[model samples]
Every structure is written in C-alpha cells, then in structure tokens.
Target: MSKSFNAYILESRDKPLIIMAELIRKALIVRFQDKRDKMKNYVGRICPNIQKKIEGLKELSNQCIPKWAFDNLFEVKCHGEKNIVNLVAYTCTCRKWDLTGIPCKHAISAIFFKHEVVKDYVSHWYTEDTYMRAYKYIIYPIYAG
Candidate 1:
C-alpha cells in the first residue's frame, strides 16, 4: 500500500493535513530504508505480486489510462471488473484507505490513469527517511548553539 492511499482514509474521517502527512511519512521511510521511524525492521510483508503489477503499469510508454475510468483529480471509476473505487487526490472510494493508512488497489489503478507518474516509486509508500533526508541538516535547533 502506498502512503497516498493511506492519506485518503484520513479523508473519510476528515483527517487534518498534519495527520495525513504523518502517515505518509512513516510509510515512505519504511519503503526506502526497509525500516521504520524508530529504526526497527518491518514486521509485516506487502504482496510481491501486487508490487510486480504496479511495475508493469508504470512501464507503459503511452498515456495508457484505461477507458472505463474517469480522469478528474478525484473519484475515478474502476478499470473494469475490479469493484475497487479510486479517489485520485484524497482516497479511493473502496474504503481501504479510510480503514487503514495504506493505498488500496483502486488508488494504484488511479495512478495508472495518469501514466506519467513512475509506478514503482508511486506504489512504494512514503516514510520518515525521505522527509528527514530532504530537510535534515537544515537550520539546527535554536537551543543547540
């Protein structure tokens, strides 16, 4: 599950930006470092089969968004047979994102709707490592010196 999907669940409960961002951060860190914010190894496993599917969709060279789905930023229809619902910006209608901080199948499907996004990176959830790595070593704590 990607971090953005997780964020969408927050959408259902009316999650504040701060809370949504926090969950995204955790997911990313785990993906990049194979560890969590507290430096602990992940205890669970995401489906490798799903990972491969996400990869295949990303590799497409054309704007191959399936015809059955919508293109707006939010609420795209399912590809075909999949009952999953996709919420483009906030969450997928399938409610997986709402139930848990994870990108459901629909969210991934929406991402494919806009093939420009790199699927491998998109599907990989966010984590604190990316956040800290991006902004760390910036102005130190005021009390430090």
Candidate 2:
C-alpha cells in the first residue's frame, strides 16, 4: 500500500506541494467515480463478497445441531463444541457475529432452525445500498495547471 502511494508521489514529485495535492485529488476523484458507476446497476441485497462468505458459512452450518432454549435463544452444538445464539440480539457466544457484523456458523444454524432468511439477519452495512452509499459523493475535478 505504501509502495503504491509512493509511486503516486513520485509521479508528481517535480511539482509544488499544492500542485501535487491537486493531482492526487483528481486521481482519487476519477477512481471513486469509476467505482460508483461500476456498481450503479447492481441489484443484490448484499455485496457479492460478503454474500459469498455467508454462503460458505451456510454450508458449515449444516453440521451444527441447534436446540431451542427459549424465546429467540438457541443452543447449537458443532464439532463437539457448544455455542449460544440469540436471534433478537444477533449475537453468538463465539463472538464472531458481534465482531464481524456477519453471522457465525452457530448463528446460521440457529437462524436456519427458525426458518429465517439468512440474508435478512446480515448487518445493513454489508448491503448493496450501503456499499453504493459509500461511493455516492463525487469529488469534482479542478484544472490543476
């Protein structure tokens, strides 16, 4: 990452600081606009990368056995390890869901047991709308002569 930034700096090293800054700003605007346009027609509920991760976890969830404990609570056993899942809170004893904003295998099993849509439980931050919102603002170009 540092090397990439260094290359950008090297390209504008002969110019004054103000000119260098403007060049970098213009480069960033172009990059951001490209990204925004690229995702403009996306229709997925969640971002593709995050959905892929969730699909992988869904397969793993089949190995887990979920037992209903109480309202919105479940005990899941997987590979001889026990975990607690709370649907309302969107948490698991393993803490993976709490930290990553993505449900862990245990939570997946619990959600499956309840016949709930796995994608619905995912954090809004991983949604396609949120991803688009992140690149929504444009950086207008300036004549940096």
Candidate 3:
C-alpha cells in the first residue's frame, strides 16, 4: 500500500509544476477529509478491530461466569475452563488481551461483573482522540515559482 502511494507521489512530483502542486494538494485534501470523516463517525468509539472484539465480548459475557478475586482481578469460567483476569494489569490467563492489546471475553466479563466501562479498559491507541491526533497536521500547498 505504501509502495503504491509513494509511487503515485513520485509520479505526481514529476509532472509540470502547476499540475504537480494541484495533484499533491488534491491528494492530501482527500486523505485529510477521509480521516476527518472517520474520526467524526467514530467519535467516543474505540478502533474498528476493538469494536468487533467488544461485540464478541458481549456474547461471551453472557456465557461466562465471573468470580471476584483480589482487587481488580477476577476468575472467569467458560466451557469448563478457568481463566484469570486482572483488570489493573489488563491481562488474562489466556494471554489474548496481553498479546493483542485488546481485552478478551473473559476480561470483558470481569469488567461487566465490576460494572466498569469496558471501553475504559481498552488501550488509548484505539481511542478516537488518538486517531485524530495522528492526523492533526495540515498539509499546506507549496506555491510553484
């Protein structure tokens, strides 16, 4: 994807100065607009992958049983297996959350048990604020001499 994008940019730069500036400006504007629309649509929402994970978690929460452990920890049982969840550490015995930076169903059930916001447990990288911050810079058009 990046290779194709870089190639397009390189080709654009080789065009006549007036056309090059216009092409680059249009490309940047389209990209910026797309990102802005995405950010607007997902305001107060987590990343798309995490959203799907949360949906999976909602279903799992119904099937799993949660027992409180020490502070911020839980023991969840599903399908005859026990998985430990530590809310403070954002980890699960299955290690899915630790490996993927997204909460697993067991952890989600634990959070539901405690009546906490599941989105809070999600990583900041998945937050809308972080997405917007990544694209906050304006791409200015350079005047062709």
**Predicted structure with the largest TM-score when compared to the true one:** 2
Model 2 residue 124 distance off true place after TM-score fit, in angstroms? 1.0
lDDT of each: 0.45, 0.89, 0.85
lDDT of 2 by residue, 46-129 (tens): 887899999999999999999999999999999999999999999999999999899999999999999999998999999888
Order of the predicted models by TM-score, top scorer first: 2, 3, 1
Question: Best by lDDT, which number?
Answer: 2
lDDT of 1: 0.45
Using all chains and alpha carbons, the TM-scores for the candidates as numbered come to 0.32, 0.84, 0.73
Candidate 1 residue lDDT tens string, 33-88: 54233334332233344445545544531232333445534343444333334444
Count of backbone clashes for each model?
8, 0, 0
- Per-residue accuracy of model 3 over 1-145 as CA lDDT, tens digit each: 5897787688697789988878878898778878878778774578776687788878977889999988898999999999999999999999998987778889989998998889888888888788788878888766569
Q: Which candidate would rank higher by lDDT, 2 or 3?
A: 2
Model 1: residues >4 Å from true position, as ranges? 1-88, 116-126, 130-145
- How far out, in Å, is residue 72 in model 2? 0.9
Q: Can you rank all candidates by lDDT, best first?
A: 2, 3, 1
